[model samples]
Target chain A: MSILKVNNLSVSFKQYTSGLRQTTHQVISNLNIELVSGEILAVVGASGSGKSLLAHAILGILPLNAETSGQITYDGEVLTSKRQEQLRGKEIALVPQSVSYLNPLMRVGSQVRSSVRKRNAKQAQEEVFQRYHLKKEVGNMYPFQLSGGMARRVLVSTAMVSGASVIIADEPTPGLDKVVIEEALNNFREFADQGCAVMLISHDIESALKIADKVAVFYEGTVLEVAPVEDFEGKGDRLRHPYTQALWRALPQNDFTWIEGSI
Target chain B: MRWQLTWNIVTFLFWKAIKMASLLVAISFISFLLVKNSPIDPIQAYVGADMLNVSQEQREKIEEYWGLNQPVMEQFMSWSSAVLSGDLGTSMIFRLPVSEVIGERFLNSIALMSVAWVLSGVIGFSIGILAAMNTGTWIDRMIKWYCYTLASTPTFWMGLLLLIVFAVWLNWFPVGMGVPAGVLAEDVTIMDRIKHLILPALTLSIIGVANVALHTRQKLIEVLSSDYVVFARARGEKGFTLFWRHGLRNIALPAITLQFAAFSELFGGAVLAEQVFSYPGLGQATVEAGLRGDIPLLLGLVLFSAIFVFVGNVIADLIYRVVDPRTREGKSYAVKQ
Candidate 1:
């Protein structure tokens, strides 16, 4: 069964000014996607490609300015019109791009423990605490005491603790060192192995290629292509679409091939 | 290594406190000595025709008894010695021991200032956190405008307005002063004093609360923008729990430090507000001494005020250390005396 189905989804943000004309900026337009249990879907795009917004719509955590339309079905339930908030921390969990998701004043272990204890079985909670290598006292130490890698681990663990069947992670590896990125990718894989659907949003094509079973390239607030990772190998020139071809070539080749005149 | 560093910090702070205390005492001595060196004598003001017609010997004896006939340096040294020995000398105008007079009034001012301090700190800090949590919304804008207006307006004017509304118009309690006359400490009920105190304390504190609110708002806003606050939000922190538990804990250090500084200011600012309301407090007594040129009384009050400032800052540092233990252990940490 498809864990989550997002059909023809479009989201816009309203901008207002006292004496100036206001406008609506479409952030995500007519986006169609599916996430099945035990699968990893990578959403790849250049910065400002609205990959994060798509994940937010799926998680039902979009900002107030966002006006969303179209159908979103989660776990065979029609997720339309009704607020999608109640599904969060239970049916779905989000790993945001920024590390600021954890309260800085709280200990890493305590926050993560609380996240899972709210919805998790007690046995699973203890297993998670041990798997994360979190000391009992670590839960008492505030966020400032943690390093960047520790923070990322805490965030992922928090999502895992929620016991959501689907986890949406946005740019999980950005600004992290190679070691931290490897750890995060491994953690995502572990979540998928547990029969949970995982959505990895990224701006880096290489990183997306490494872990994604299926890659969805988003451009101009819409999905341009969705294909298996093997399909893109040596087929960059025959991408059939100008935007897709541009994105393929935009990959860092050590020769500085910058895509021009393409959004 | 950490223990050694901590030991060094403690030792450094201990010496620093001693140095500051000695410097303060020396400065007080020098300034008062200069006043004693001045040529003018108060006995001249007291000498009337009856005393003038008296023998020169009697006048000289009178000066001797008052210790005015002593050498300037000797008189200054005696004053300093007495201060060191805990005798602040008798007030020339009030004819009472300066320390005794201050002791009687100190508690009343502290009572007013402490209440105002805690009231403003708690209210302003909470509001600031709330305002920051819902930033960019109407609630945030409302808090911003309210804090801005209160911070800019004069505290005295706010006090007067509160007095007019709560006292003159509403008749909620006694108008001006801490308590009504003939309301003895034993005879007056606790509720009566509280009712009487409500207006002045509220009046004096509102502006302070506003000032604190702005500081707390700014602190919370900065904290919320940090990568960590985003983490908390993602974890499902919402409403008052988010504000108090997450936002408050993060922004508390600065807010608490500001509150401590505000305590010192409370007493200093209370002089005008207290006088306006005819409150029989230390601030009012200090003003009376200033007007009468009561040097001993004035110096005594100034010392007491300085002590309050010093103690306030020390308390603030202690509280900060308690709240954030990392501050005391890190390289960038500030050690308090």
Candidate 2:
């Protein structure tokens, strides 16, 4: 079933001018996408490519100056600006970059427990806690006590605790070492295996192609192209669009670039 | 576990404060010596013009009576020794013990100041939090305007304005004085004294409330922008829980620090407010003693104000340690933890 779908999503921020003038900067323009249950859709783009902005718009956590106009249907219910946050914890969960969500003052275990209570479920709370290998007393340890890798694990664990059908993670592992990235990618795979719709937003094409069932490329505030992971198999030159071809050639395995001028 | 941590923090803070107090003592000694080295002589003010024309024998007798015949170093030592021994010396003008004079007025000021602080801290912080939560809205704009206006005006001027509006224009409260003369009479009721305290307390509190709100609003803005607040919202915290429980707790450290500074300044500001309202508080006592050049009283008031500031900072530091465990753990607390 289609758990989440975005149709014609566009977001703009109001720009103020001195001397009674004003304008609007359209940050995300005409973004359309869909996610089915138990599928991983990867959003690939470079920095400033509006990937995070799109995720924020979908999460309904955009700034006050941001104006969003689009139709989003999650589980057949229309998504509106007013109800975006309502969908966030229950219908959708967002794992922001950096384990910043884990408040430094609060313990990792308590943070996860809070997420569980917010979901109003007590059954799987312990199960989830144990599955993450979090010490039973870990709730007593504050976020500052956790290592960077441990903090990220706790964040992912908390996001899944609420049983939100869809998870949108932005730049899950941007600058981590290879081992940490592998761990992060494995975490996303586990979430997807739970029959949850997962959207992995990243700039690394190679990382996205690793686990994504469907891959979408974002550029200049729009989804440029999307295809199955199968399409990336030894078909770099056969890609239809110039941007997609550039992206394929830029992958680590395809360092042999026939086209210059940078993807 | 949190209790144990807090207990450790409190003990550690107590030792830190003791160390800080020792430093304050050194600072006080140096300042006393520096002041003594200056041109002003308390003796010159005490000796009458007739004494200069009198015999040196009689002058010497007078000097001995006042303990002025001793060396300057001995005099300062005597003063510090007296202070440490719980004797602030006699008031040169009042012909009364300095401690007695201060004790007479200290309770009144403490009472009035406490009332003013509570009013300001609660009301101001609430307004600030609400305004910040609704920033860009009309309520936020209104609070901004009010806070700016109140914070910019001096407390004395604000007190005067209140006196005019409530006493002269509306005739709702008494003018210039704290309690009525009858209230000081032995037979007067306690309720009457409270009634008289209202105007002075409000006068002192108006500016305090404004300042608190301004500080709280600024700090709340900083806190709300932090990532933790976003995380809380994503955790489905909406409405009152979001603003009060989540947002307020995170922003509390800065707001509390602001409140402590505000509390420290309350004594100094209350002097003017108390004087304007003719309230029999420390400021009024200090002013009366100052006009008469009562050295003991002046020094006592200065010391009291300094002590209040010192205590305020100590409380702020203790609270900071409680609010931020990382602060207790030091600069590398995050890494260490």
The candidate maximizing TM-score is 2
Question: Candidate 2 on B183-230: residue-level lDDT in tens?
Answer: 446766777668667887887777787877877788888777777777
Interface RMSD of 1: 4.9
Can you tell me the DockQ of model 2? 0.49
Worst ten-residue run, lDDT, model 2 chain B?
A: B328-337
Locate the minimum summed-lDDT window of 10 residues in model 1 chain B. B328-337
RMSD in angstroms, candidate 2?
3.2
Candidate 1 lDDT tens digits, B1-337: 3676668567756975886697668768776875566553555534533555768788788888878888877877788788989999777667899998899788778777777888888999888877877788899999899888987877678778887887889888787766678767678777777876777688677877787788888887787666555444455555577566677677888888888877666886688778777777889888877766677887898888877787777767766655564564342211110
Docking outcome class, model 1: acceptable
**Residue A205 of model 2, lDDT score:** 82
Q: What is the DockQ (computed on Cα atoms) for candidate 1?
A: 0.26
TM-score of each: 0.83, 0.90
**A1-263, model 1: which lDDT tens digit per residue?**
58898899999998886667788998889899898788889988878878878876776656667899989998788875343656666667888775566665565566776676355444454566568765444455555566677667767877888878888898998899988898889899889888999889998778778877888888889987887777665647546666666667666663335566653
Candidate 1: what's its TM-score on chain B? 0.83
C-alpha lDDT of residue B145 in model 1: 94
